[model samples]
Structures are given as C-alpha cells and as structure tokens.
Target: MTSLDDLPIRDDLRGLTPYGAPQLDVPVRLNVNENAYRVPEAVALDIVQQLARALPDANRYPDREFDALRAAFAGYLGHGLQSAQIWAGNGSNEVLQHVLQAFGGPGRSLLSFTPTYSMYPLLAQGVGMRWVPVPRADDFTLTPQAVREAIAEHDPDVVFLCSPNNPTGTAIDLETIEAAAEAARGIVLVDEAYAEFAHDRSRTALTLLERHPRLLVSRTMSKAFAFAGIRVGYLAADPAVIDALRLVRLPYHLSALTQAAAVAALRHSDAMLSRVDELRTQRDRIVDELTALGYRPYPSDANFVLVGGIDDPRATFEALLERGILVRDVGLPHTLRITAGTAAETTALLSAMAALRAE
Candidate 1:
C-alpha cells in the first residue's frame, strides 16, 4: 500500500491537486460557462455523416499535420490566414501547453494579470516554468501602462492575456494587448476562447497580428459553436510560431473523427452559431437581473457573469446547489460566477437568489 508521499513524484506536484471544475448533475448547470444550446440538428447530422466516412480510416493514423482542419480554420478566421499560421490541439489548454513547452522552462517565466484563467499558472507549473501573475485593477481591468511596467520589471519569456477573461468576464481592449506585446521581449498569447460572445466582433486581437509577430490568438469551438464535447481549439500566429509548436505536439494527436467532426461543424458555422444572439440576450439579462437583485454583476462580453453580493458565497453556493441549480463559486469573496444558461435555468437561478435574500 504505497501512498503518493512514498512515491517519488516531482516536488512541485507532490501536494498539488488536478485542475477541475465541479461537474454536477443538476437540472440547471450554469457553472462552467458552456454553451447551453445543443449543436444545431443540421450540423450534428453532418458531423455524423462525416465521421461515418472517416471511421474506416481510423484503422490508420489521422492526418499528422491536420492540414485540412488548418485550412478550414484559416477560412473561418478570414484575416488572410493560412494553414502555416495555425496550430491546434484537443483544447485551447493544450495549445497553450504547447506554447509553454516550446518557450517556457525552469529559468524562464510566464507573466499574466491576476484573477485570470486559473489554469495559466498551473500550465506553467506543470512544465517547471515560473508563473508571475500581476494584479489587475479593482474593476478587473488591465491598463496599458501597468502592462508596460510589469513587462519592464519582470522580463518574462511569455505573456498571457485572457480577453473576456474567465471568472470575472472582463475584456481587455487591443490597446492593452499591443502595449504588452510591444513592451515585452517575448511571445504574447491572447486567450480568446469566449470571443464570439462579444457584442463587437471587431474588438478581437486578431486585427493586430499583421504588425505583431509575437502575438498569438487562441480560439475554441467549445463556446459559441456549442461543440465543447468535441474538444477543438486552435491558434493564429506567425508561421514561425506555428512551426515551433509542430516541434512540441505529439504525432497525429488529433483523432480522425475529431478532425472530420470539426470540419463538418465549420462548414455549417453560421447555422451552428445562430444561437449566439440569444445567448447574448440571456447573458445581458443575467447581468441586469443580478443588478436589480442588488448584486454587483460585472459587465460581461462572455457567456457568464461574475456577480458579487452574497453574504457568504460558499453558503449561497450550497443553497443554490440544494435548489438543483449549480453555479461556480470561484473563491472570490462574496462572488459567484454563473453561466448564462437557458431561460428556464436563468429563472431558476434568479428565483433561488430571491429566496435566499428573503431568508
């Protein structure tokens, strides 16, 4: 009966826990910021058909280069991108892991603003890279001047900017990204996993790529595409950067079925994404509803809202869980982050909130 303490694991990981969000089986699940809508019927049918076609080739290895998926991704991005400028993996987390593997190491460091995607530091630590998280403003906003100061002081090997960031749902403008890239002497990665839910599509950091070779923009099919189960995430960057990632990624990593399924979904992206507007409506409704309920809901460009007002967030989370509506208690004091689930789910959450307040 050997325990973990007896086995010789890496000292850094000896006491650490794995990354996870609660996967509860409640009637209303607004915890992980997953798109509530199922994949469009047409797209699902196409995926089934395409995977059926690719199933025979599963006996052989998938496209080691994933060339077709890259071409489709280029078309999807449509800012004069090519397959040479793209790289992908099971999810954006894996893509970022590649970045860290290629550039981050024991002596090097990764810099990002605080209260960001909690995974950033974990990714760095997994590879023995130092994670330096600077604090954001009280409103959860990053300023260009602050970015310059951090870069000037830390001189990290990589900088991460999570736009429409997780937990807080705060979005950083391109100016801040530009400043960070210009000030830093290393790669600047923008995590745009929630970009499609933004009110203004033009706010994306993709537009600045032509001038900033150091910039990398990561996106995923999980959110607006309603394809979280399929696990397709990609990055747009300089051809040299993509080439470097090729050195780190495992051979034929993406399965043939995943590639086929992603291609099918991308071909019907318009139909697949038709629910975004409705989700945005629901997200805003949550923001307004929380405000009216005397909670402080941060303005969100993403699908979830981070609201603060609970007398005890942990207790409120337990109360909501008992009511069959599960939301995220992100360790922020008096705050809980919730996905903008379907209308019925939203109603359940609001009803629970009102009931708890009255109590």
Candidate 2:
C-alpha cells in the first residue's frame, strides 16, 4: 500500500495534521460553531431559482470578476464600501489563503495571538511564511498595548485579529485594531466571521478602513447567514489591496452557480439573518446555565461558550459523545468549547451536564 511517506512532499508539512472538527453522526451536534438553524425555505427556494438561471451558462466560464456578487456584498456590508474594494473566494479559508499568497512569502512572517483560529498557522506554513504566535491576556482579551508590543517585536508581514475570537469568544476592541495598524508595517487583517453574533455589531474593523489603507476586514456567510453549504466568503479593503489579491487568485475562481446563489442570499439578507437574535439568546442561556453548574463560562460575544473548571475535559467530552451529543475539546486544559444550538438541543446538553455533575 502507498502512504504519504512514499510520496515526495514538503518537509515542513511532515508532522502537521489537517485542520478539522469531528463530524460524527450524533443526535445533538454543538461543535464547529456553525449556525444551528437550517436555511429558511423561502430563501432556499429563491437560491434554487438563481441556480437554475445560472445553469444555462455552465458551458461558458463564469464571470471572472464576479462583479454583481461584489456589488451585493458591498451593499450588505454598508460601511460606505464600494464594489472595487471587495474580494471573495469559495470560503473564508480561501479568501485568507489569497491574502497570504499575495502578501506573505518565504522570508515574510504571519503573526497572530495564540489560541485563535486554528487555521492561521497552517495557512502560514502552506505559504512558506513564518508563523509567530503571541499570547493573549489572562482573560483571553487582547489589548492595544499587547498589539503594539507584539508587532514591534515580531515585525511580521501580516497580522491577523480574530474578532469575537473562536474557541474562546472574546472580541477585540476597535482601539486594539487601530493600535495594530499603527504599529505594524504590514497588512492588518481582521477576521470577523462571527461579527454578526456580537453584542455591538457597530464596533467593527470596517470603520477603520477609511483611515488605514492597509487594514482589511473579512466575513463569511456560513455563520450568520446560514449559508455554509454554499461556500461564500468576502473581504473589504483598499482598492489597491484587491488588485494585489487578484494577482494570485485563480481564473473564474467562483463558479456561476456560487455567484448566483450568494447574490440571491444577499438579496434576502433580512430574512436570512432573522434568527440571529434567537441564537444570541441561546448562547446567553448556555453561559448562565453553565455558571450555575459551577463551571467557569467565559464572557462571550460570539454564539458559543468556552467552559473551564472541568476536572477532566476529555472524559466529559467522551461522555457527551456517548450520549449522542458532540462538542469540541479545543485542547484547552480543563475546558471544552460548545456551540449554541436550538433550544431543545440546549436542554439536552444542560441535562447531560447536570447528570454528569451529580455523578
């Protein structure tokens, strides 16, 4: 049998594992931070119509620019954004990879705080860029001072700030973002994949773009829009930055069906995002119930909670899995990261945790 070792591959990737969350068949799945709700039927129908319209053009290549999709994204973002400033890919992962390919290279470095999106280091290594990890504060919050110091020391080619950060759910303040742009001589990319789940959506890096040409803000339709399966992600930056990304992007990267579906979803944006408030409610419920169970639930602005104070995280994770519930153990000692699901799913999780406590 052939194996990875038998083929010639990059030595840098020898021991690294692929980034993924468990995809087990379970009754209750609260892992991966995906939007728990199914896409609204009306919106789904409209997407079908759009895809049908696009099917006739399948023989021809898709619009290389995806101009209509870009316009729709600009209007949805609504921070005085223009279509010229937008760039997108199959998913936010591809969008980020585009940035790395354009701006990051062999000698350059990518810097971000530790315990952030697990994909950051992998993306850096794939591009042959040096990965620099800086520690966050004790509460998992990042401060302006910390941003300044890290940029000064590392002087990386790019800095990534994950607002409403994953696995912990701590949001980065605008002050810290400004400080980073001021201190770093390279690109400042803010990953706002969960921004719609934040308590104050107004406080975003998009507001800083007017003053900082090097700043960029990336978003995904997978979470808030419940459009995960469609694979749409975009970012806003200066027009010059978009041109740089274009240099590395594949020709007609986004297929015609993808563009049509995404544009149709954006057209019904209000209906697609109607469940956001409910998700926020469920997330708060998780925090409160976990605290009452004597666990330490960190303050979260995203639709998930990072719980500490467990005696054995892996054991508890396995127990939950046995009960047909799946959550994430993000390798945080004595901690487990659980996503906010529907009300009934929450009830099941809390009941299981209560029973675990009693035992």
lDDT of each: 0.91, 0.94
Question: For each candidate, how many residue pairs have backbone atoms clashing (under 3 Å)?
Answer: 0, 0
Give per-residue CA lDDT, model 2, range 142-198, as digits (tens): 989999999999899999999989879999999999999999999999999999999
All candidates: CA RMSD (Å): 0.9, 0.8
RMSD of 1: 0.9
Instruction: Estimate the lDDT of model 2.
Output: 0.94
Tens digits of lDDT, candidate 1, 121-225: 999998889999898999999989999999999999999999999989899998999999899899999999999988887899999999999999999999988
Off by over 4 Å in 2: none
200 in model 2: Cα distance from truth in Å?
0.7
TM-scores vs. true structure, each candidate = 0.98, 0.99
Clashing pairs in 2: none
